[model samples]
Target: MWYNIDFYIWAVNLLVIRLRKPKMIAFVKSLVTPIVNIHYDFLQKKAIDEFILNHNGQVCYLRKALNDVFDNELRRIRIGSGNQYNRQYIYTRAEQKPVYLGKIYIRDKSAFADTGIDYIVYVPKKILASRELELIKWIEIFNEAGTAYKIIGE
Candidate 1:
């Protein structure tokens, strides 16, 4: 009968709509994902910048520690173009020439710490063995204060 055919058509249409509803929603969500990601990235960058700004003062302390001259104003200068490694300071004592030493990398503790980075000193390739224990001890002090450090080099 006509009524039975109409009912079948109506049921099929309802079934099709029910099946397609979630797929349509997923497609729309996929389209919005890029925009959501951009916003998330923007917010993350802002938070990181704020965190860096707040914690950059630790750099001076790090410089003083690395230079082993707490009293002297640290004159740490970036070594290469990128921030992977940098000379924390030049220790020029008594008759010694300005050594191209005191290099260090105060890298990010994690990509997620809010203070930008905790006490994790990445050791450079050329630190003197004599200074290694001292450096480790110094880093240990910070590490004990809930800031962990590691010695990584080539």
Candidate 2:
């Protein structure tokens, strides 16, 4: 009876081992590995994407950071238009047209040349008075080395 009981216990252990789902564990691992790898790849590439070199070989990650920062903290400020030359709209009264005099003219100086400045941070009048120096220092700290920037109030 003791030998019979020991044999039965061994058989039960073998059956339990056979019942264990190794395939299911492998399937779960297969399903999860790609997801984990994709997230890891994205994190790695995100760090790379944040850094970029300018024409002068200076690291200009601030261009990307500035976009994010401006979008979040400085809603009233915007980067100037044009990649080659910065552009801005000016409101002025027409000097030659008396019939249209006193009426505000929105002028676009399309012939403007690049001013050798790298980045133009345009701030609305109200914010510029209060934060000009702060914005300048922020740009100085983050902008590419030796790059010039202007803070214009609109």
Task: Report the lDDT of model 1 for residue 129.
Answer: 41
Candidate 1 wrongly placed segments (more than 4 Å): 1-20, 58-122, 126-154
Best-matching candidate per TM-score? 2
Candidate with maximal lDDT:
2
- Candidate 2 weakest lDDT stretch, 10 residues: 51-60
Backbone clashes in model 1, listed as residue pairs: none
Error of 1 at 133 (Å): 26
Local distance difference test, candidate 2: 0.53
lDDT of 1: 0.47
| Each model's lDDT | 0.47, 0.53
Q: At residue 153, give the lDDT of candidate 2.
A: 77
